[model samples]
Target chain A: MANIAHTVHVGLGDRAYDILIGDRLLDDAGALLAERFPGRRYGIITDDNVAKAQLPRLLASLDAAGLQHSEIVLPAGESTKSWDLLGQAVEGILAARLERGDLIIALGGGVIGDLAGFASAIARRGMGFVQMPTSLLAQVDSSVGGKTGINSPHGKNLIGAFHQPKLVLADLSTLDTLSPRQFASGYAEVVKYGLIDDEAFFFWLEENQAEIFAGGPARGEAIARCCAHKARVVLEDETELGVRALLNLGHTFGHALEKDTGYSDRLLHGEGVAVGMVLAHGFSARQGLAPSQDTGRIVAHLKKAGLPTTLAEVPGTLGSTEALMAAIAQDKKVSRGALTFILTRGIGRAFIEKNVDPKAVSSFLDDMRG
Target chain B: MANIAHTVHVGLGDRAYDILIGDRLLDDAGALLAERFPGRRYGIITDDNVAKAQLPRLLASLDAAGLQHSEIVLPAGESTKSWDLLGQAVEGILAARLERGDLIIALGGGVIGDLAGFASAIARRGMGFVQMPTSLLAQVDSSVGGKTGINSPHGKNLIGAFHQPKLVLADLSTLDTLSPRQFASGYAEVVKYGLIDDEAFFFWLEENQAEIFAGGPARGEAIARCCAHKARVVLEDETELGVRALLNLGHTFGHALEKDTGYSDRLLHGEGVAVGMVLAHGFSARQGLAPSQDTGRIVAHLKKAGLPTTLAEVPGTLGSTEALMAAIAQDKKVSRGALTFILTRGIGRAFIEKNVDPKAVSSFLDDMRG
Candidate 1:
């Protein structure tokens, strides 16, 4: 039987778009985009890694569909998300002669998606853009949201805009190319949707863990499920002014850990999120909002899936608690100098807690240190 | 009797805002802002000129109203609209500890408004910003629209976003500090409203030229009338997809002249616009769209107002016609390499003309050279 695809619609009025999930979706990217943006030229932005692994497939598909395209390949890494590179990417798109009517295709992981999305957003006061996300992390998270920006020295994503893509093509087959560690890092986000507010999804993920890690039909199902949930939340609050804050389930603690690691490979974003989720659960228990058994169960699940569940599991020695606290204070979510965290009453139950006390966070960190 | 204020409300659905026009309105700035954004801190971005001449009155108002503010004063010039300075201004706002809920006040001419507005649009994924336009050019044009961006080597405003301001306070009193030459530069934009679609307003300005330039009630009335026209057009098309293009009446030729003059003091934006408007009228006659007498009348009125109305009147030699055409090609309005111009059918009868022949434009410049 042919592999069936699932379409998740992000309903944002005129800015609405669909996310197509299936194996080998890139083979159909040309047809998918041509229908929506007919006769428009394309500027494809990807990192060097993706260029080597996936560019040929995308190019062949476009060529077969009689579409014209130009490719801009930057170096592969987190460092690519900078103002200098952003300027270069924008200039590259212009150099390709892609006008406002043309489309920009982000054909790489999170970094390329962000840089290209931003370039598209500001070019001609916004041009259309499509996401051909290649990594597990991007396929499930970054590509679904319109959050596009470059990192500032002050913080990650401090300078950017909320520019949604015209369409998103998530090919699960691309996950086959990810390193085991990279794949596991993305799995962390899949686990996140369950931990956010879906008890049934969490139980399902636990039961189908092996099939998902083995890259079967279960993997695609997990990605589609996560996207559908995110799409619903985004449709309700596209700018993240209200209920969308719930989507930052492990982000507060996760961002601090990413900063502590200096945004290095020492802690991939998914890995940081995995540990952050555990810490959030632990902190909730300390505050008597959740049971200690709930925290233990979360750590056990993360460990079973080969994800780090504790700060000690991180490669480098995380300095003093004060250092982490300082990083958390600089989070984009921090408003009016108060710490805001996504705490939970139990598994699958998260809520935004604003004006959280620094002393309380400090005490919790100290206890976790043991 | 006290001068009654005029309010032009821009109807952009949820993004709607009001442009307030009055004399000595700065005295009520505190109470005005506090009511809409109560107890919110402000980050004021201005230039050295405004900081010295007008910052004191603004500071006094804020102090009297008990509002907190921090100022970032940049050197005054078009050069301040570069990426480096944009980064500095954004970083400055962050350093001031202003967050998402805080408001940024653009407290100078067009340069400050464009730079600060672009910064606020991207800072923390966008913070609210208010425009306090101090120049006639800013009050009548730039302050009304949310077109915020920085110039690139490619062309002016090639990089920007359509981020609207939350409020615009156009204090007629600020124009008192402008030099005669500076005031004339702003007068060019004032004349634009009449040329676009309001023959009655143009005739009114013609009849009251002396009083309008002499800082009388006519000046405030002219400014308010221009703002009201702009507000209505912006509400109808906030993103320049349709009628908004009508607002670029003299911009194509005006921008090319500004580029030819190196965007320097050799030709102020309004002065280039003054010449560009005449060129547009001359071009319109060349296309048989309007009578040559209309072009002559425009030149006569601009001359009476002390604004440059011909290319030869530019302070420096504007290079060859070919060079000028090159700059026009790089304009943001050029869609798919086709020239788009705002040519008039007659006074107060402007319309967008797409795919205009480059040969016709070249020949028009040749005839004007004589």
Candidate 2:
């Protein structure tokens, strides 16, 4: 009845840290943080939406622990992941009088985590940070990766650093406050872990879809399992030199969709990724790497989760296939003008395919759009 | 003569790189960089002054090596080390289409090196970079340490990342174009290497001052030795957690003087450091850590090098000892509101002194001013 928590450790020798998953983590944050960090001031960075819904609880926990803190609440949106806001967050942390030894608490979803994590990474060359991810997307993915960054006009997350968090507290209670749309958007990444490599987890998610979405024990287990998978991948390749690229399963296509929509609300990151995962499967089938049944299955699961699963389901005008290809070419993963994508052979069997032909991808996009 | 060059290897394991020092390194840069990095596009970030004097030679070298290159020339001055310029440098590098594997060549003094290095540090989570230090200050100090950053209104270098370069080319021929004042300013750091922990090096500097100023073999040897010392310190403490702080012997006091001068031409960074070194030694004498003769020897040496060794010699109005003390308090070296100073026992014997009494420092400043 203590609200059981699961711990996933990311092992990088001296830089190793743990992710704690459970319900009611906000109430326990004070004690957990104090026990882990010990006598450090906290600078809390959250988005306005999270501030309205979650900040008070987190602050109460910090106060209960007698931990002194200062908070900066940024606007809630992808646009908040800009250079100006990143500078503001860093300056705010400094103004709060946090030193190199102090810790920054990223208290919102991926935007806040990415922005705050980046600010922490570069402040005083580096500082300790804790990720209190309030969204499922962050809980299972971004918060665990240590890939903190801000968006550039040229591309998403093109400017930033790889600064890992000292701790991550994925409080399940916060997920309940998320709109069904937001929750499902994040579910795309949740399914991503399965599509990347874990067939059993994918099958488990397929069967427990109801419980997973109902905030039951399945939710916690799914999040924990996803984090564990991510941690293992990150530990093996901290700098994304090799196997880590597999983690970007839907991102190449996803980033293109997001860019096509100008990163507007009409196409949320996770929505783009949802559709992208389907496309990745579809493209894999088109490339003769997988059967069309795999693509159909992925699309079915995404649709069941109330997530966008195809180019047609995307909200805006996605322009020509050539334009989408152009956007894809701008992806950070593109190497020396060559396309690099994480294409799947089947469900839970994705592999990094480098120098994928642009013409082939463009023709596939044309087929998908048609 | 093959223009004898010396190489100092900074040992940071896989992050290790070499600093090559000699005359006319600009002529050899094409082959040197090609041999080291190989088949990578080079994005050159330089200041106007360097572009005017050294760009053609460097460009010719790249062309000779058949390497693709793009260059961004920023206005020359200390002021270029700002967040705005940092953004421009980053954007410029990206515009050049330099990817993660590409090399960014920082081809100017400290300002260019710091700005370009920082841009490389965050662009694409980091890109490869090489240092072609044209100024003497950079050749001996900033270029070797891998401490890259831009200045903030809050404080100088209060924000940045520790990004090592792949190679450093210290072209002594470029120093021939430096004004006497610039050369003397750079000599301060060279003298500092000896003052930090090498008495014999200090004695050798005293003997070879003329040769060093005249740009003889002694000049390359002195630069190479300083780089070697810095390389060792960085390898041991890449993040300034311990022994690396010793390298900031005069920086605490020097940063205050630079701030007092508003980081203008009135006090070149090295000039402030010249006077700051004297103050540090004087304060050590005041605290009975070293004999007065040690302070006198330091002042005499700086004076002989045409460097300012006293507060009265500073070109601008330094408000008050209290103001100077306040500036020192803002130093990045300040740990948790505690004053940290690198006070010396004598020439060639410096150590970290934490929580130094603020009042004691103020009175020492007052006495020095009087």
Among all candidates shown, the one with the greatest lDDT: 2
Q: Ten residues in a row with the worst lDDT in model 1 chain B?
A: B1-10
Q: Write the per-residue lDDT of candidate 2 for residues B136-160, one digit (tens) a residue.
A: 8999999887899987666778889
Candidate 1, residues B143-241: lDDT per residue as tens digits? 997999887777778778899999999989999999999899999999999999999989999999999899998998899999998888888888898
Error of 1 at A274 (Å): 1.1
Q: Give the fraction of reference interface contacts each candidate recovers.
A: 0.59, 0.54
lDDT of 2 by residue, A1-370 (tens): 3354798988888999988888899889998888878889999999989999999999999999999999998999999988889888988876776888999999999999999999999887789999999999999899998999988888899899999999899999999999999999999999999999998889999999999998889999999999999999998999898999998999999998998898889998899999888888888898899889988888889899999887988876778888788778878897878899999889989999997999999888888886
Q: Write one digit per residue (lDDT tens) for candidate 1, span A115-230.
A: 99998988777898999999999999999989999877777788889999999999888889999888888888888888889989999988999999998889888999999989
Candidate 2's docking class is medium
After superposing candidate 1 on the true structure, give the runs of residues whose Cα lies further than 4 Å from its correct spot: A1-4, B1-4
Task: Quote the lDDT for B96 in model 2.
Answer: 72
Q: Each prediction's DockQ?
A: 0.68, 0.71
Docking class for candidate 1 = medium
True lDDT of residue B218, candidate 1:
90
Regions of candidate 2 where Cα sits further than 4 Å from its true position: A1-4, B1-4
